[model samples]
Target: MTEIESATTPAAAHRRPASLRDWLAPPIPGSALWGWLGPLFVTLFAGFLRFDRLGVPKAVVFDETYYAKDAWALLKFGWEHKTVKDADSLLIRDGSDAKIWEDGASFVAHPPGGKWMIAIGEAIFGATPFGWRFTAALAGTLSVLILCRVARRMTGSTLLGCAAGLLLAVDGLAFVTSRTALLDVFVMFWVLAGFACLLIDRDRSRRALAEKVEDGVGGSLGPFVMHWWRVAAGVCLGLACAVKWSGIFFIAAFGIMVVLWDAGARRAARVRNPYAGAIGLDALPSFVSLVVVGLLTYLATWAGWIFKPGGWGRGEVAGNPLLRPLEAMPDLWRHHKDILDFHNGLTTAHTYQSWPWDWPILRRPVAFFYTEPRDDCAAARCSREILGIGTPAFWWGATIALIVLVGVWLVRRDWRAGAILLGFMAGWLPWFVPAFGDRTMFLFYATPMLPFMALAVALALGLLIGPARQATVHLARHAPSANRRLLGSAVAGAYLLMVLVNFAYFYPVLAAKIIPYEDWDARIWFNSWI
Candidate 1:
C-alpha cells in the first residue's frame, strides 16, 4: 500500500465507530469549543467596519430625522410623539430646545416595533449622532455573527460560514445600511435572526425524529406530539413581524416549509399514515405555535400605544357613550388606523421610486444624501456627496449566483441552496405584488435580503470547491497531482482578496465622505445612479 493508505489503515482499524447520534450532529468537524472562534472573528471584523467613523456627516441622513427624534420622545414620554420638520437642525444647532417636542401625533407608514429598538439607543446616548445610529450599527455587526453561525450550520463548514460572513461584511449596501440610522437594517437583522432560528429548529427536529425512529415507535416517529423549537421559531417570527409587517411573509413561508419538512420526514421513516400524522398531529400545533403565537407577539409590540392616552388616535372624546370602549382606546391605536390609510393611499409618483421589476436590475435608486461642495481643489472644480446605490460587482455577481443556485438546487437537491432561495423569495418576491398595485417603493426595500444573496454566492463558491477531504487519507494516496488541490485553494483565496479590495475602494462613497467630482463620477457608473 502507498504511504498515505498504510498510515490511515491502522487508524481506521483501531477507530471506535461513532454512534448515529454523532453522525446526526451538525457537520462541525472541529471540537465544539473551537467552533465559536469563526463567529467571533466575523463579529469583530463587521464591528470594525460599522463603528469606524460612525458619527461622520454628524447629522441625521434621510429618515433618521424622524426615527432619531421619535426614539428620544419614546424614552422621555414612554411613547413616540410628533416632531417638527427640520428637527435634526434644531436638535444639532443648540441645547436650548433639547427637551421641547410637540405632543401632537405623527403620521408614519411603518409600524412602531423598530422605533422601540431605536429608543433604546437614544435613551443611552441622548439624541446625538452616536446615540441614534449606535443600535443600527450594532445590529448590523451582530447580523454578521448570525450569518456565520447559520451558514456554518447549513453547510457543515465553519470556514465556509466565515466566508459567507466576510462576503456580507464587504457588501457596500450592507455596510452603508448598517452604518446609517435606518429602520430597514433592523428589519434585515430580525428577519435573518428569525430564519437562523428556524434553521436551528429544523436540524434539532430532524435529529429528534431520527431518534424516535430508531426507538422502534416509528408509527408516528414520535412519542411526543408537541415541539418546543417550533414554538421558539414562532416567537422569532413574531418578533420579526413586530419589526416590520413584511415579516408576515416569512412567517407564512417558513410555517409551510416546516410542514413540508415534517411530511418528508414521516415518509422517510416509512410511516404508512405519514400525511395524517405529519399534518394532523405535527402540523396543527406547529401552525398554532407559528401563526397564533406570532400574532400575539406582534400585538404585544403595541403595548405602549395601548397604554398611552395622548397618542395619535387616543384622544377622540366626542363619540357616543355606547362607543366609549372603542373610542376611549389608546391614542396609538387610533393613530394606527390613520397610518394604515396613508400607507394604502401612497400610490403617488416619486422620482427615485422604483418598480419591483426594475429592482432586480437596480434601474432606479433613491438618493439618500447629496451635496455639491464649492471651491474644492481636489477635482479642479467641485466635490460631490452621495449615499445611495449598491456595489455593482457584489450585487451583479450575487444576482447571477442566485440564478445558478436555483439550477443547482433543482439538479442536485442541495438543501443549502434551497434555504437561501427560500429567504430570497420571502424577502423579495412579495414586493412584486404591491408593486403591481403601483405602490411607491425604493431599491433600499431590497436591503434586507442582501445578506441572503451574499450567502447564495458563498454557497456556490463552496460547491465549486467540491466535498471536503480534510479527514480522508485513502483518496490522497490514489490521486497523483496532490499539489493541484492547493492551486484551487489559492484561486479561491485570491478571489476573496479581490472582494475585500473592492469594498475598500467604495468605502468613501458608501460613507458619504466628500470626494472630487471626477472620482465620484467615476464611481457612479450610470446616470441613473446619480
Candidate 2:
C-alpha cells in the first residue's frame, strides 16, 4: 500500500489499540459532586430570576394574549378555542376563568405542545398569569441546568459550565420570556435538552468504540454501538419539534452533526475506512434512533387533539385532499399545511418586527409589556416595562467568540467548537431564509440559540485560560505560561463580571419593575432599543 493511503486507511488502523483507548476516553473533569453542585447553583439563580414576580404586569402582555388564553383553553377544553371580546381585560380585572371562551374553534398558528406545557401551569395555578407562565419559567430554569451540564461535559470544566448557565440565567431576553407566557423559552429548553443528550451520546459511543479496540477487535468494520443516549436525544428533538416547527432544523442539523461526529471518532481511532464504517454501521441506526424516533415523538405530542376529534382540522377518517375544516375535513398533513401557510404569509407589518440580521445585535427587541402606571413608584413619571432584549455583553461577546471559534475549530480540530457553531446555525441561520425573512420575525425567535451562544462564550473562556490541551496546540520555546494563564484568567473574570453588572442594570426593564421613566430610558441603551 502507498504510505499515505495506508496511513489513512482503516486497515492500517489495526496497528495497535493503545493510542485509541487513551484518545477516545471521556473528557469530563473533576469530582461528580462539584460538577453537580456548580450547575445546580446556577440553576437556582436561574429559577429565582424566572420565578420572581412572574405575574407582574398582571395583564396579558404581547403574545400572551394568544398563548395564555390558548393554555387556559387547552387545560379546560381539549384544544384552542376562540375567546370572547375584551377577554384580557375581563380576565385580568377579576382573575376569573368564567365566560372567557366563545363557541367557535380557534385556528392556532403553532403546535399545541407549547400551549400544553403552559396548560400545566394554568392547571396548577388556576388560569392566572402566574399559573399560565409557571411552566415556561420552569422550562427556562431547567434550560440553565441543561446548558451547564452539557457545557461541563463538553469542556470538562465545571467552572466554565456554570459560567454558561449563569450567562443564560442573567440574560434579559431569557428572563422576560420565562416570566411571561411565551413559546420561545420552551423551544429553547427542548433544543438544549436534545443537544445535551447528543453530547452524552458522543462520549459514550466513542468510549464504547475504544473498548472494542481494547478487546482486539480489528481488521473489521466499525461495531454497532448501542445509542440509548442518542435515542433520548431524538425524543428531545421531537419535543422541540412539537413545541415549534423551527426544531425541525435542529433535527436536520444535529442528525448530520452526529453522523459527522461518529465518522470523525472512527477516523481518530484509525478504523479501516472510517467514513464507510460510520456510514455503513452508524447511519441507519442513527436514522431509526434520531429521525424515526423523533418523528414518532413529534406525532405523539398531538395526542390530545387526535383523540378529541374536535381539532381545527381532522375529519372522519381523513377524506378530501384540500377541503375546508368545516366540510369533509382533511388529515393531519393538510392541517399542518394550513399552519405552514399561515406562517409563510405572516408578514403583516408588526411595529416590533425585526429582520433576522437584527437579532444577534439586539436591535428592535419586542416590548412584551409596557405601562405608565398611576402609582407604586417614587418618581413622578413611573414606567413598568418588560423589554425582551438580551444582555448586550453576552450577545456581543458571543458574536465575536463565534468568529474566534471558526479559527479555533480549524486550527485545533476541536469538535466542541464545531458543535457549538452547528447548534447556533441550526437555531439561528434558518431565519435568514428568504421566504421566512419576508415574514414578520422577532428577536425572541433567536431564543433557542441562546444556550449555544452561551456555550461559545464559555468554551472561549476555557481556551483563554490556556488549559494544558490548548497550550499543547501551540508549542514555543518559552510561552510565558504563568503570565498568559494569569492574563487569561483575569480577562475571563472581567468579562463575566461585566455581563453580571449589565444584567443587573437592566433588571428593571427586564423584570417589569416599576422605575422612573428616565431610569428605564437609560437602560434602553440606544434609540433602536426603544
Mind giving the per-residue lDDT tens digits that candidate 2 earns over 368-408? 88999888788889998889999999999999988889998
Cα deviation in Å at residue 137, candidate 2? Answer: 0.7
Q: Give the clashing pairs for model 2.
A: 10-271, 10-272, 10-273
TM-score of each: 0.88, 0.91
Candidate 2's C-alpha runs over 4 A off are 1-19, 93-95, 315-330, 435-437, 468-480
- As a whole number from 0 to 100, the lDDT of residue 429 in candidate 1 is 91
TM-score, cand. 1: 0.88
- Quantify all predictions' global Cα lDDT against the true fold: 0.72, 0.82
Steric clash pairs (candidate 1): 313-335, 314-331
Q: Give per-residue CA lDDT, model 1, range 67-100, as digits (tens).
A: 7777777666655688766677776664224545
Task: Using TM-score, give the best candidate's number.
Answer: 2
lDDT of 1 at 445: 80
